[model samples]
Target: MPRPLENLRVVDFTHALAGPYATNVLAQLGAEVIKVESPHGDLFRAYGDDRELAKLGMGIPFVGSNAGKKSVSLDLKKEEAREIVRKLIAESDIVVENMRPGTIKRLGFSYEVCKELRPDIIYCSISGYGQEGPMRDYPAIDNVVQATSGMMMVSGSEEDPPIRVGVPAADTYTATMAALAILAATTQRARFGTGQFIDVAMMDASLIFMYGSTAQYAATGAEHKRTGNMGFSGQPTSGLFRCSDGHLVSLGVVQHNQWVTFCKAAKREDLLEDPRFNTIYDRIDNAPALVEIIEQLFLTKTGEEWERQLSLGGVPCGMIRTVSEAMELEQVKQRNLRVPLNIPGMPNADLGVLGTGFLFAEDGPAVDGPPPFLSENGEEILSMLGYSNQQIADFLASGILQPSKKPETAK
Candidate 1:
């Protein structure tokens, strides 16, 4: 099967998580992404827990997101480098950047300049706020965006202090949203025969993940109170419960029939007939009493037993698992969501790295190669742009073009 974006070329000027991850998605979809890096490389190259990997500038975090791309390091301040980039953009289909607003313009490769180079170039700029906001120039990361977007407020229990999510929710979601918007723009280009300029803001994309509570607040003028582990339904039966084994089991018994089934499955049909717990409202009113009864019932069975019984009995239930436990699940392994990558310098054994969040039936998402070393393909990329061997060497010697230096670990 033919890959979807196999014929497309992308000039990626993104550095950190959101921008890089966004173009990484396009790369997995088969775009030939040429990652434009500065001399020192992306800051994320020094991020992650592995000391050796960090030393090599192939930190786990960077490795996870940057597979399937060629790297070209250039000092944009130099006219020679800017000329090379202009040549690249002229031959590319898409251009993406995550710099502060107006920064790219100062670097001489703004949307106007790129559009001049390639009339139908789809240019996307991912920023903290957007191109035209008061806070547009403000710096933002995952936690900061979470705090500003009101996402942190709705994450923890009402009594607890606001808690940013453990993962880089803002970066991850924003990247996904940007990739989606880029694909949508491609579709639009197909119809209109003109490229589009996409502006994606981390704050705006963060709110999309909170659409449920955001819409509710908009419709009713009521703020959402954080309910901790409770399901969105707010049903007494739909929350995390401790099982006999001291493990937590989430029960999603929202529908009336599911509640009835839950009660029957637990051998506590008395809950069904209890006046204080008969209806959804009644249960809400007597939540403490209902929760106490359910808690005691759940404590009588191990998490596995409860999962098996409740799930087989048509009640939505599952044991809460740690990341390692979740990854070890047979179902997860069968799904092949994570792909094994042969990262150079790690070891002979294949290293497992994350792929696209979704799958395609025909030519599914896949990486063409491992995450690049800094300017790993600079010489080759320059050659492709019609630069001769002498010109490339001269540029490299003059510090206009930085060449790749494989880490000592790889040697």
Candidate 2:
């Protein structure tokens, strides 16, 4: 089965999380993504403390986000390497970069240069702020963007210190948004017969993700408060509760009907007649009392038991699960969210990575292969560009192209 973006060619000049993640999405959708890296390679290759994997040129962080793409290592500081990149841009349909505002332009491959090479190329630049802004040059990563976007303020309890989200929410969301913008630009180019330049800022993407709370704040001129483990509705029953087995279950009794159903399921139908818990407003007003009662009732059953009963009764609820446990779920397996790929040069031949979030009836998103070793495809890429054997060797010897080192065999 043919993939959606099989015909598209991408010259990916991205590194670290945000940029690489966006190109990964494009690669999963079947685009030919050529990931160009600097002489030292993407910093993410040495992000974590896995020295063993790093020695093998397969750091977990790098492998997780960079599968299904070819790697081409080039020292952009060298004129010869810059010429090779220009040649690549001339043949590609899209170019993506996530560097400081003026860095790419200084490298001589800015939007203007790419447009001159490929008139209909889609050029996307992801950054901390934007191309033209006061803070455009400010350095930022996921945690910094989270703090600046007020995301840290809205997480955890109001009394707790501001906490960064456990996952790299800013980077991940920015990548997702960048991919969406790139696709939109592709569509626009198809219709208008001209390419476009896209500017995606991590801070801007984080703010967009908080649109609901921002809208409320704008309309009421009041700030949204942090409510730990609770829904924005603030219903007494819509939060995490500890069960008898010491596990937690998250309940989301939003609608009036769901509240009534939850009461019946937990044998707390008496709550229906109580004046303080009768209406949504009353429940919100007397959430403390109602929560105390629900906590006692939940303590009577294990989290799994309550999950079964509540789901059977049509109340939205789920048991809190660890990452490993969540992945082991039968439903998740059925969705094929985790897939195995045989990555070359790695000890584990059948390692698994996540698949695309959605499925298609036919050929959909897929991991084409394991993440490439640094410049694993450099020779082949240059050859395809009409470079002769001697020229390719010269490029390698001059440090214009650095190929992956062969894995050492056991002594």
Counted clashes in each candidate structure: 0, 0
Which candidate number has the best TM-score?
A: 1
lDDT of 1 by residue, 65-93 (tens): 89889899999999999999999999999
lDDT by residue (tens digit), candidate 2, 1-411: 689789899999998899999989999999999989987888887765667777777777888889989989999999999999999999999999999999999999999999999999999999999899789899999999999999888888889999888999999999999999998998898888989999999999998888867878878989888888899888888899999999999999988999889888878888899999889999999989988998998999999999999899888999999999999999999999988877654565567878868998988899998888788889999998999999999999999999765454311
lDDT of all the models against the reference?
0.90, 0.89
Worst 10 residues of 1 by lDDT: 343-352
